[model samples]
Structures are given as structure tokens and as C-alpha cells.
Target: MKLVIVDDEPLARDRLRRMVAEFPGYEVVAEAGNGDAAIRCVREQLADVILLDLHMPGLDGLQVARTLAELDVPPAVIFVTAHSEHALSAHNSHAAGYLLKPVRRDDLAAALARASRPSRAQVAALAGLDMADTPAYVSARTREGIERVAVGDILYFWADQKYTSVYHLSGELLIEQSLLALQQQLGSAFMRVHRKALVARRHIVGLRIDSRAGPLLSLRHCRCSIPVSRRRLAEVRALLEN
Candidate 1:
């Protein structure tokens, strides 16, 4: 596997490079000091994975990841940051892994082992073939590492402050992407029932009138009800009837 290490600090990059050298079958194809250089190196070297630092001078790691996502064959990103706070943002950016500063060998090994390769859909999209409008899975960072929840299994998405909660068949997870972005990416499979919530059309059981909440959307396999705004109440009802 070819790897690109991106860190503003030369020492940090050297440490990562040395650690990576210890691992067999993986080579450091390139190294960069900033996000722009990182992007350039990845493209030039055709790197398979990137060890990225979050807090750089310009075009932070998150911005770089977003830009890379637009590429026909984007490389897997593994954020190597000191801040734990950006974990949700990293996962939302579809990062393959998140490692704190002073990265451990075991953690780096595990992350590389599970690093995402270009999906078949991505390959098809590059070939100008028909593909799904949205990604097949939404990822979340956990104690066990990155867990991917199938988009089809998602029941709803609720925006809570800075994070958007993804309610799927198994449970719930928080991602940093906004509702508007998700709505745009997910397309017709999800409906904007409220300003703060998006419900899966396939999981909609019905819309029920709530005495206090006015209107609430009931979803299959979900215990809690999602409040529907009065402005969108008619739309939700129409969705249910259809």
C-alpha cells in the first residue's frame, strides 16, 4: 500500500515516516507539509492512503478531504490529530481512521488494514456507468474503530446542535455533516420532514398528530417520534399516503 504523510511539523512527518517504514508491504510514496502539497503529492504519486494532520496553516485536513472526495479515485484518509473533538468531523468526511498525535504502531496497523479501497460504485461512476446517487454507508468513529452503517438501514437523521445523529437499524451514531448536505446527497430516499430532521421514506410507518408536538413522524423500528414542522406537515402526510 502506498502512503502519503501530511504534517506541517517536519518532526511529526519524520516520526510517522519512520513508524510506517517498520510495517511491511507499505511504502511512503510522498510527504507534504500542508494540505495543498498533500493533495498535489497524492495526485502525482497516486497514493492509496493519506496520514493527515487536522490543524494546518491553510486548507485544513477536513477541507482537503472534501476536495479529494470529488476525485474519481480518492485515496483513503486517516486523520492524525491531537484533538479528540474533531473525531465526528473526521468520520463525517469518510475517513478510514482517526489517530491521535503520538500515534501507536498497533493502532496505525489496524487502521491501514481496514483502510477503504475504491468501491465498485466509485469505479462505475468513473466509467460513466449508472450508479446510486448516495453512498452505500455512513461511517461513525467508535472504540472499535470506524463502523459503517448501511444507508438503506438508516431510519432517520436528527440534527442536534453541531452534530447530525444517524438512526439506523442497529442504533444511533453522530456525524458532523449538516442536514442540507445529507438531504442533497441522500436524494429521494430520505424526506425532509422538519428543519432538523430527515426521515427515510422506506421506513415511514405513518404521520400521527401529537397533542403537544402538533405533528410527529412515526418510523418503523424506531421508538421515538420525530417532530414535523407545521410548514412541512402537509408534505409529510403526502409522503405517508404515497
Candidate 2:
């Protein structure tokens, strides 16, 4: 199978490349350090499988998987992660299989075996999106390189002229996609808290309405006070009340 591997760590990429070479049926077609490069690789070269890493500098594996879900011929996914907490989530995402970090040969083979099988339509249905809609995952190029961060991980999105900055629990990432396009694609989980910002409901810590400052929304672990537009204040209040 033609395969692509994406991870941020150089050692991890090298190790996986070596391991993939050892596998008889699988051939490493491309290797990328971030999700953006991985997407470009997959688009340029038809891949049967993608060995995706869960965490990276710019984009995480889940975002890449979500983006691929919108493709007509999405490659089978085998998620590689160090954390055990993500295992259930991967299963929930209907990943072909998952391998723990410092992957063993046997584990790689097992994941490949799972990938070779037919995919369930139920898994596709769970993505909850049509292809025409803006993808839930956006590819961004950062100083560290290209990353694929999931829309769900994003605490908020802010527009900066030609660029859109995505703020997540990890950090901020800049993407070329327009903020308006992102707002439309982001589901109800994200709301327009301000004209310049779109905030994720899950990340919202508290809402404070000031007669002077107007309505303020705070994101968890985030220090910045996000302004809520007059039109969106009622909606924010209603959401918080519920």
C-alpha cells in the first residue's frame, strides 16, 4: 500500500520511516513533519494509508483525519500517539487502528491489517458534514512548519486581514484561510463573540457584562478578555444560561 507518514519530531519520523520500510506490503510514499505537508503529499500522490501522529507543532492528527473525512477517497488512518487518553477518541473517530508511540513492528502490522479491511459507513456518517462545506480542519503554515489543528481544539479564531489566527489550548496558529470561511464551517460549537473573534463554547470560562466594556467572555486558561458584539451578547448570554 502507498502510505504517507506525518509527525513533528524528526526522530519519530525517521523511526517510522525505517519501520515502514520493514513492512512488506506497505511502501512509504511521502514523509511530512506537519499536517499541511501531509495533505499536500496525499493530494499529489494517491495514498492507500496514512500513518498520522496525534500531536505536532501546528496541526494535530485528529484535524487531519477530520479533513480527510470530506474527501471522496479518504485514505485509511492509523493514528500514532503517546497518550493513552486519545485511544478511545480515535476509536470513536472510527480510525482503522491506533498504535502507541515508540511503535513496535507487530503493532504496525496489526494496524495495517485493520486498514486493509472495509470501512464502515457508520464511521463516515459520524463525521456530520458534506464535502461541499468548508472542512473542519484547516491547514496552516507556521514558523515551525505546517500543522493541522482540529477545529474542536481551537478555543477561538481571529481575523487579521489576509490571515486568520487559530487559538487553541496548545498555542496560536496562522492559516491562509479566511476567518469568514472558517466561521461558516465551524459548527455551532463556535460563536461569533466579537466582530474580529469567534470563540468556542467549550473554551469559554465565564461571561462578564460591563456597562463600560460591554459584554466580555473569557476562555479557559486564556487571559485575554474577548469582547462580545452587541448583536451577539444576547446569544452569548443565552448560551451561557443554558
Candidate 3:
């Protein structure tokens, strides 16, 4: 696979290039110092993957990834950053991998091996296009790697401190996104049942009044009921009635 290395520091770029050379079946097609240059290089080389730096002077990695997503066939992005805080943003950008600075050879190889060209639907989703009135998928970082859950399969999202928990048909995972951000991206299909939770409108079968918890939402496939705030109780009832 063709790869593009984008980093402002020449030494950092060199280190990545050397590590990439150790691996077979992959070649460094181009190198860029900044986000704009990286975009130009990717377009010219038609790179299959990009080892993108998170912090840059101009567009920044997130902006560049969003721009690349607008292309007809966008390459997979693997964010290489010193900071771990941007993992959530990288996930939102549809990154193929997330690597920390001072990258290890094994991690780099693993990331490259997993990297593949993203589909048009994925590209649209990365570009933040509401083509289907909601994002195609929601991503979470796991011990293995990045895990993506289809929006249709999601039951609800519960906010737990810094991370938001995703409950889906298959199982539950954690994503680094605010509940408000998820609600906006998910659109009308998800309702903010409480300050800490967002429930899928389609999965909401009924609302039961709990003696202890007050009002709780019953989901189609979910075993546990989601707590509904008193403020949003009227709205939830209206939605169920309709």
C-alpha cells in the first residue's frame, strides 16, 4: 500500500520512514511538512494510507482528515500524535489507527496492515455529511484497535464522566464523545432522555414509572431501562404517544 507521511519535524518524518521501510508490501509515496502540503501530496500520489500528525500550523490533522474525506476515494488515516486526548477526535474523523509519538515498529506495522481504503459511505460519514440524516457509524477505541458500531444497531449512549458508553445490539463499548455531540450527529432518531443519556427513538418501546428512579425508558432489545429526567418526561411521553 502507498503511504504518505505528514509531520512538521523532519526528524520525526525520517524516523517514521525508516520504520516503514522495515515492513514489506508498503512504500512511502510522499512526504509533507504541513496539512496543506499533505493534502496536495495525497491527491497527487493517491496514497492508500496517511500517517498524519495531529498538531500542525495550518489545517491540523483533524481538518486535513475532514478535507480528505471529501475526495472521491479517500485514503485511510492513522493519527500519530504525542497527546492521547485527541483520540476521540481522531475516532470521529474515521481514523484507521491511532499511534502515539515515538512510534514502535510493531504498532506501525499493525496499523498499516489494518489500513485500507475507506468506502464512499465512510468517507461521507467522516466528512460530517448528513447524507442519511445521521452518521453511518460510531467508533470506539478498544484494547485490540478501533471498533465501529453501525448507527442502526445502537440502542443508547450513556455519558460516564470523560467517556460516553455505547450500548448496541451486539454489546457495549465506550467512545470519547460528549452526549450533546453524539445527539447532534445522530439527529432525530436519538433523543436526549436525560442529561447523562441519549436513547434511540426506534428502540424506545415505552416508559415505565419507577418508584425509586421515577421514569425509565424501556428499549426494544435492552434488558435494563434508561433513566428519563423529570424535565424530559413530558417530551418522552409525547413521543411514545405518537
Candidate 4:
């Protein structure tokens, strides 16, 4: 797997680079001194996974994660931090896993193994959604490995130049596909609610007319309100009314 190491301390990056040498089939694609450099390296080098440090000068790990979340093909994040309190935040941010400072080779291997394994339920879930007639799985390449994800579990898909970002019930994953291709593969179960957004019909709970901003739709588990494009307002309303 193509991997990048991001840490403020040079020793930390060196240590991880040395330890990663023990793992077969894994190579250090790049190394960064801070979140900013890490983001640049991952984007330019197409890193599959990133071993990211939580604390740093300027942009921190969480900030890096948030920025990565916006990317079309985001690397699977494995946070390497000393603080346990940030564990909850890491999970909330949909990170693959975490490793403490002075990471053990065993722990790193285990995390990679978990990331590499296919979730059996993913296939079953796609079957249940009855989207087999269409291409419903997306290929997500992360720092640990590549994974196949069921599109049915995806809450929404957003276009990013040359790639698509998928937000699902369990977590977020990114794949290199145009929004047009994703919309085509997803078929009728998904609707293009806006020029850049496609939402799952199942995740749309209700539509609310925002007096100031016009119309909005509530997503099942997401707290933020999703805007209803003027052109799609009628369709969104009809979908909800039905």
C-alpha cells in the first residue's frame, strides 16, 4: 500500500518509517512534518493511507482529518496520537483506527489487517437494497488498503474533480469516479438533489421550507440540513410526499 507518515517531530516520522519497514507489502510513499505538508503530499502522491499525528504546530490532526474529509479521494486515516481523549473524535471523524505514540509493530499490523479485511455484510447489504441490477459498489483505497463499499449504505455522494466522495451510515470513503458515473451507476434509488449532490432516497426523512433560504431536506442521521435546489424542489417534495 502507498502510505504517508505525518508528524511534527522528525523522530516520530523516522520511527514510523523504520517500523513500517517490518510490514511486508507496505511502502512509505512520503513523509510530512505537519498537516499542511501531509495534505499536499497525499494529494500529489496519491497515497492510499496516512499515519497522521494528532498534535502539531498550525493545523492539527483533527483539522487535517476535516480537510481530508472534503477531498474526493481521501486517504484512510489512522491517527497516531498520545492522547486517549481524542479517540472519540477520531472515531467520529470516521478514521479507520488509532495508534498511540511509540506505536508497536503488532498494533500497526493489526490495524492494517482490520482495514484490509472485507466486510461480509457489505455484499449482503447491497443485495438487500436490490441494486444488483446496477453497479452499486465503489472501490475505496485507504492508507491501510483498498475496500469495496456498498452504495446502498451511502447516505450521499458529492462530486469532487476527478473523484467522488461517499458518505455512508458506518463511515466515509472515497473513490476515483466522476459524479456523472456515480449517478449513472446508482440509478433511480439516488436522486441528484443539486448540481453537486446526490442523496439516497431512503435517507431523506422530510423536506422543510426554509423561509429565508427556500427549501431544505433533513437527512436521517445527519444533523445538518441539506439544501434543495430550486430545480429539484418539486422532485424532492414529491419524493417526500409519496
lDDT leader:
3
Best by TM-score: 1
- Taken over the whole model, the C-alpha lDDT of each candidate is 0.84, 0.78, 0.87, 0.78
Show the lowest summed lDDT stretch of 10 residues, model 2.
118-127
Residue 84 local lDDT, model 4: 82
Cα lDDT tens digits for candidate 1, 1-242: 78999999999999999999998868999999999999999999988799999999999999999988788878888999988999999988878899998899999998886663345444344334445556778888877889888775688999989998998767889888899999887777678989899987766887878787789888866889989999998887786676
- lDDT, candidate 4, at 36: 91
Alpha carbon lDDT of residue 123, candidate 2? Answer: 25
- Summed backbone clashes in each candidate are 0, 3, 0, 3
In model 1, the runs with Cα more than 4 Å from the true position are 123-129, 132-242
Which 10 consecutive residues of model 4 have the lowest summed lDDT?
117-126
Question: What is the model-wide C-alpha lDDT for candidate 3?
Answer: 0.87
Weakest lDDT window of 10 consecutive positions for candidate 1: 120-129
- The candidate with the higher TM-score, 1 or 3, is 1
TM-score of candidate 1 to 2 decimals: 0.52
For 1-242, candidate 4 gives per-residue lDDT tens digits of 68899998999999999988998767899999988999999999977688999988999999998997676556778899988888888888877779987798899988765554323233334234443456647788899899877655677887777767888767788788777777777677678888778887767888888889778778875677777799999898887787
- RMSD list, candidates in order: 15.8, 15.8, 15.0, 16.1
RMSD of 3: 15.0
Model 4 has an lDDT value of 0.78
